[model samples]
Target: MAPSKKMTFSRRSFLKSSALASGGMIIGFNLFNACKPEAKLPVDLSALNYNDFNAFIKISEEGKVTIFSPNPEIGQGVKTSMPMIIAEELDVLWEDVYVVQAPLDTKNYTRQVAGGSQSIRFGWEPLRQTGATAKQMLVNAAAARWGVDASECSAKNGVITNVKGDKLGYGDVVLEAAGLEVPEDVTLKDPKDFTIIGQGKGNVDIDKIITGKPLYGLDYKEEGMLYATVLRPPAFGQILESFDDSEARALPGVVDVITIGEKVRAYNDSGKNSWTMPMSGTDKVVVIGKTTWDAMKGKKAIKAVWKTETALESSETHDKVLLDLLEGNKFNTRRQDGNVKHAFANADKVLERVYESPFLPHNCMEPMNFFANVSPEKVRLVGPVQTPEAAAQVVADLLERDLEDVSIDMTRMGGGFGRRLYGDFVYEAAEISNAIQKPIKLVSSREDDMTMGVYRPSSKYKISASIKNGKITGYHLKEASINGNMYGLIPNFFPAGAIENYQVDTANYKSNITTGAWRAPYTNFLASAEQSFFDELAEELGIDRVQMHMNLLDNVKNNPDANIEYSPERLQGVLQLATENSNWGKTEAGVFQGLSVYYCHNTHVAEVADITMEDGVPSVKRVTCAVDCGIVVNPFGAMNQIKGGVLDGIGHAMYADFGFVDGVPKSNNFDSYQMIRMGQTPQVDVYFIESDIDPTGLGEPTLPPIGAAVANAIYAATGNRINKQPLINNLEPKEKVLG
Candidate 1:
């Protein structure tokens, strides 16, 4: 099959074009091309015609528009929200606009990554400009035909009207517009004039998803493609030594057995450690067969020997190491303001607490899977991945092929809480295909997905505060974790500006176990610890929790810090909105409440959890949340993200637990791993702060606050200050609670 033609437009080279055989207009713009020095402006388009250009916007003779979305969709609703931004500024009817996922095009797109909840935030301005520019060109064409000044013509709902009341549809002038010179400047709609944005629009793929369409990597297949299942080391410190595959090869449908990872192992041993590279070890045994079942069975039949290069790590040992680091005096100071040592020495009162959390797996609904076909000419990769460009690069490097020879097609991901950000699975598929010189689909069972995962690091935090004469004078925080510490930007958030003598110190112990970003990353657990500590500090100071937080926010707002990364005004707004809507100080009988507020991912969120006792057990009944993520693109999709984040926060903090014993994962599947069920979900009420500011991240900001809210509420109902995660472990017995 011949590759499709793509024409990319930018502020520079806006009029550059090629001859096309059709009578329509297709427009596209490189989101980041404006900053490049290489883009030449005002290219001649007199020799060009319209025919076969396929890009962001496609206009038909019937006036229908198709906008291609360029970002990978990992259940963050970018697929729906991104195109909405274009259609809004293009002045097109929403019902007449169709959306399609654009294939990976690194040449024409930037920041295609899906993690960090930054898709909408980065695409806001560029997308609007593209749409508005196309609409302006259409209006210009209509004005020229009417022999009137372009400024005298107006466009609305894909139609252009002049001062004389002459009208022309976008489709009528699209072909002529294609030949016209691109305008250097275009007018964007004011927020108040927005008709499609901020309105509720259903997800474009909702129908396909509900009808069980093949949208995920696990559902993808190709003609003449084989299946592959890999056998990896059971423990982190172990590596593949040898494997006997004669019995496995004798199986009925088993095709072949092979070994991979020598090159990767050499790369890792070269003394330059790269966190972005695969962490699931470099040695693996692959079993290929005609079907998935045959491959899995052959893998089960193989006999493999492993060797350990380092001491096997256990959760108990990690616990001791983290606690010991906290108790010791040696640490790395992340941030410091004023004189913390003097403030602590001269304080009237001192309070301290330690909080701990276990490692967690993403446990996406669809297990890891990828399809690869490698040949001397080109490499084709299809799968669900959060970082498609990174995956393509890794595969290119692994196969020792040119980067341009590799192509990626991103399918809709079932779930990617940062786990899919790594391209280990993609590398495996490509490596196997390159070795066998055939197309193959690599599938991982649930057990494989869980045990061999880059998980959320287990961590511990010790927070201390000094109160002098009914006011907090000093604040200090110490962090200890596995592999890494909190991101450098986090120490400058919230309490940094609020306290005069504040200090933050961090320490970590390196282990063979692989750990990386999970959900909101460090903030997922850090927010819970800090918020819970603040609640206890308020109680010790004889002040109301809400008032205490408000006062602290005021301090930050009054005297801002140069290094502070959050907006005090925005944080205060969400806090006030959440408290007012949840009736913070007042609740009906049999109800107990808790509140928490946090800022991350360039967004602010506040939550209040309401709890009720059912049969002597504290049960979360509802949660109220207020979010300030700037202007919401799609209220319906935004609501879903907020609600899903809140529930996920509650579920993980309440039930999710993971551990390693003798370097092997303790839980291999959901039966062994604990998770909150459908019956345990709380009613989440979300409210958005009205604003015209550009949008920020929504997917991760709401999550950081919900766990803290639920934990505080549990304390209110049971009179127990839980300082650890998987709150079920710390909750008192039903008999003791009833007494």
Candidate 2:
């Protein structure tokens, strides 16, 4: 349990490649790459190795099956669920087949990152195939031992049985089967006979989790491991100029204070700074200590110089900049259907609305941290990463080593929330490890985590509709401040020629706040703008919002009018159930109602929130959600995720906001950056549409609707739309704003 004392490492190698060795069984074989395709290769089986380890089964000499999952187990319960996929296929009890966070090895892991709510969805197919293939091989091995036909043998619960009732445990037969050539093109079990795939499987480690077992990135420990505190730039275009580490070096437990000059390469063609901090790769400050608190306390005394922004955007001037740009009317042609302008010009009545949103953050429970022991020849990285392959490349680049030398071990995450997608932190760890020539555990203080977090970008939506005789003939959308990465992916789905008489043009501008993927990314903001506008559009036409969406679904259900990639039937089903369950329009009193539907992560969801004014605030009394994520696996977990996501999204919309002063962020802690408490959670009702479709993702599917749903409700109550984000009383007002 003590950290390995292998000190042969003179210079930290950012990439560490070792052979596959665990529990006494070593399985290694053919790999397809630039080098070899038809050859059997050696691999490292250690807990954290960069070598190929496609083998799923690791049998102990005493007989226990361990399944290695290449994906990180962020708090979405994937540590429990992804293992269940292998267990279902391997026919082992959840406890019997232990799960280990997979190491970074490209040959063994495909789609190793656990982001975009893809842990379960991505592993579904391969895990199934793994189980079926293993079972088949075990059956074949048993049949040969019994001198019988393979077809007459059956495999179950890690055992192979014959017609005459001969049986053997999986471990007893693997050695024999390992020698035989694995059959190609093996058939899998039919859905009707899936004993565990579709059945309710609980979180395998619920007891450990509920009892406070050490199972998170924050809880990991290594002997002689030094904690590091990094000092980064406060804003864009900032650079380190000078520093004095003498006072820091004198502090208790202070090992070293490093001034690293991190440089990001500019594009050869454009020759622009790739980014400001992580993206731009500014040099950093490293404060080493025996403990996190000591390191942080000592970090303050380490004086350093930094350059202020040049030719840049500031938070105070960002709004004005976008407003000025809007007047210029420069927008990309996202979608164009019919003669939208002419139709709007000739319409009997026209409705227009504008909505605004503020910047956001992904405050994950486990602030970014990665444990690394890097060297120029090889490196070892152990952390929770969404993209293991990408992390591999990063370590290789940072250490200036061969890609094959880098090793990564993905641990279970306390919470990913899409924040783990960025591998920049991993780069820092590798850099510091290589710099100090010692293994280092790079950690971010809560302040560092919040202030330097890649924030969700803000935007404004301008929607216009042409209404003639109570029928929508044309629609137009002009969205501004669309600087988030979603802009790159959105146009591919909803570009020109998707809808009739429709025009969608978006203009992007810069802001002081940094941007990264949040839950549902653009959908989080898009739903709030698009859905709320649609709700108002339906009201103007005096039509039910559900019906209006259904009309749109009709267009996309068969042949999608927009180039959007979503199953219309699934989306419509969510709307169908939400309307039916909420007793739509069949209730009375001062209750405010709002409805919305959006699709993401291969799932569709519709939500209807019922609200009533409580103490001059729009408090949700109840919410009815209808979701169809294909066939449910662990239906209870699925439902729990839906319930949890709805509440999380609700809290984020109602209270979560990250502000800025000059170049630094304000409200950097939980005390100021509040989250939704249990007391605030409303009565929630969730319904999963009955279907035979394979299960879809649930982690991010429920978040996109909350902001729009709540905003719509507040509008119904006061008839004055609340356009901005963090609908709260906490703020630094420009015109001395009021709640």
- TM-score, cand. 2: 0.88
| Per-residue alpha-carbon lDDT of candidate 1 for residues 14-86, written as tens digits (9 for 90 to 100) | 3232113455776645665533334332222232111112135777657788877778888899999998998
Best by TM-score: 1
Candidate 2 lDDT by residue in tens digits, 1-739: 1221111111111111112333223333211112233324333343334354443456554446776655677767666666666667667655577776656666544566677777677666655555555566667877888889998988777777888988788767765665554555455555565566566767766777899887766777788888888888766557677788888888898888885544234221235322312455456788988888778877888888988755445555666655665566777777577788898999999888776666777788888998888765678888877777877775665555788888777777777777788877787777777788888888887778787888777667777888887777787877777373354225323212324678777787755456877778777766777788888888887888888788777766555445667766667778889999999877578788888788777788889889887656667889999998876767667877898889988998888776565666767788988899878899989898877666789988898887788888777766666667776542233233222
Candidate 2 weakest lDDT stretch, 10 residues: 7-16
Separate clash counts for every candidate: 5, 31
Q: In model 1, which runs have C-alpha deviations exceeding 4 angstroms?
A: 1-10, 13-19, 34-55, 266-274, 485-489, 560-562
What's the lDDT for residue 50 in model 2? 35
**Residue 667: error of model 2 in Å?**
2.2
Per-candidate local distance difference test? 0.84, 0.69
